[model samples]
Target: MTQDSRPRSPLAMVLLALLAEEPMHAYRMQRLIKTRRKDDVVNVARSNSVYQAIERLLRDGLIEVREKLAADTGPARIVYALTDDGRAALNRWMDAALATPAREFPEFRAVLAVVAITGPDLVADRLAERAEALAATLDVAEREERTSREWGLPRVLLLEHEHLVAVTRAELTWVRGVVDDLRSGALTWDTEEMLASRPPE
Candidate 1:
């Protein structure tokens, strides 16, 4: 039973983590995720997805309905709490996620792969713009990291943002170098000519 047939959802893991704190209704769960800035990682924009995740978690027996709350002015809400299984699942999921790097297809990399077709100057210009944007993001991440540290947040809680800053900084460095190479005419490509000259594979 440890490995069910149902597929895992990132949102389900998030719900488990939240319920581990205390039982919460779906609406409160969504609100807390947004307020805590967890929406950055999870797509809380889709309320339907949250509801679907709740249903799946309940079905998996990882979470149990704790109680039903009735309000005089609004609809009744069913609160959910993480089961022991949910806690164990959450820990397992988190450990795996932190230990492994999942293969992800970022849009920027996809665009970068085809940028040579756009020619070097335009690609360089676009890359320069992206570098600026990344630098700005890094600046914000640094400030947030400092604030978190001063607020006595533990390194464990701050590591993800720190990793983001480091990755962005490295990307900026690489991008600047690429832009320089492009502007210096060190990187050149003849798309039409190269295609015409291509041999059958």
Candidate 2:
């Protein structure tokens, strides 16, 4: 099938995936995402976002309210289920997310781009500090991976964590080299020279 031209939010996909597994209310879906640590990738931090996502999904015909449950107290809760369109969209999202490299502007990369204003010495020291912290994080990830393996968690399930560890380790190695270059005067440069080298916007 051709990909839908409409935009789909990550939260919407998360909700769709949850609904595909089983019909649930927004609150329950949000809880499952957190309880399962899926929140690490999908941002279900706000209930408002979840509700908003539901509204969008409904409007787009991706999902529908399956039933309304009257609460003992407070308002009634609407249970949602995925439509056939939603299942297709969910599969599309999964395929795109897994196969495509998004053009994401991570904060660290953005900071690194403008960090030259602070001078190489300062940036190098900061990079070294970041590397040390990343090393600690890598140690934790390694331990977690070992424990997960011992617990019989399949490799497919832990691939996301493994990818994170691999990327962080590569970054740490590059940062260490940069620190050495800065300290050894191999990357010395003046602020004015840097400014002059850049074309005016």
Candidate 3:
């Protein structure tokens, strides 16, 4: 088959991986994501999102309906399995994801670019709040990791949680440092001067 040209969204890639394990219905896939904590990386909060990805994969010929089961009380259940192309695509996506970092435009980074407009004092206060939130997230991730280890889950299985904790800790540390600089007047900026320097629309 020709190389798949569809975008490898996180949701789509994850669905493919789950199917790679075994053929399963959409509900099972969604439940597995939540139960396995893959939802932390994949957005399966909405059931419709999973169905939409399935539809796209079907259109691209990446996945096929393996079977449909008759249900006594509801709509028939459709089981999906990965096509050969889907497995190949999944492997390619994993390789690229691991070897290369995609350019991501996070809202926080965008705000930081023009944060001087908000003035250092307000920015410092907001960043302090953000630091607290990050700390709480880190705490949760650390606790989850400990629980997983206690359950005998291997380090490989908890790598993503480790990444989340490390990134959150780093961000919290950086935010606290910036807050200190702002409070000590080390990072002060002139709002009037900044406004005057803006180019014409």
Model number with the top TM-score: 3
Q: What are the clash counts of all predictions, listed in order?
A: 0, 0, 0
After superposing candidate 1 on the true structure, give the runs of residues whose Cα lies further than 4 Å from its correct spot: 1-7, 197-201
Give per-residue lDDT, candidate 2, residue 41.
70
- What's the lDDT for candidate 2? 0.84
Write candidate 3's Cα lDDT for 52-92 as tens digits: 99999999898999999999989999999999999988988
lDDT of 2 by residue, 1-201 (tens): 244632376777778888999899988988888877778777866668888889999998999989999999999999999999889888888888777765678999899788766688788888889989999988998888899899998898898789878987898898889899999999877877788788878
Query: How high is the lDDT of residue 201 in model 1?
Result: 96
* Reference-based lDDT, each prediction: 0.83, 0.84, 0.88
> Please, what is the TM-score per model?
0.86, 0.89, 0.94
TM-score between candidate 3 and the true structure: 0.94
Identify the superior model by TM-score, candidate 1 or candidate 3.
3
Question: Which stretches of candidate 3 lie above 4 Å from their native place?
Answer: 1-7, 199-201
Residue 57 displacement in candidate 2 (angstroms): 1.4
Query: Which window of ten consecutive residues has the lowest lDDT sum in model 1?
Result: 1-10
* Clashes (candidate 3): 0
True-structure Cα RMSD, model 1: 2.9
Query: How close to the true structure is residue 114 of candidate 1, measured as C-alpha lDDT?
Result: 66
**RMSD of model 2 against the true structure:** 2.3
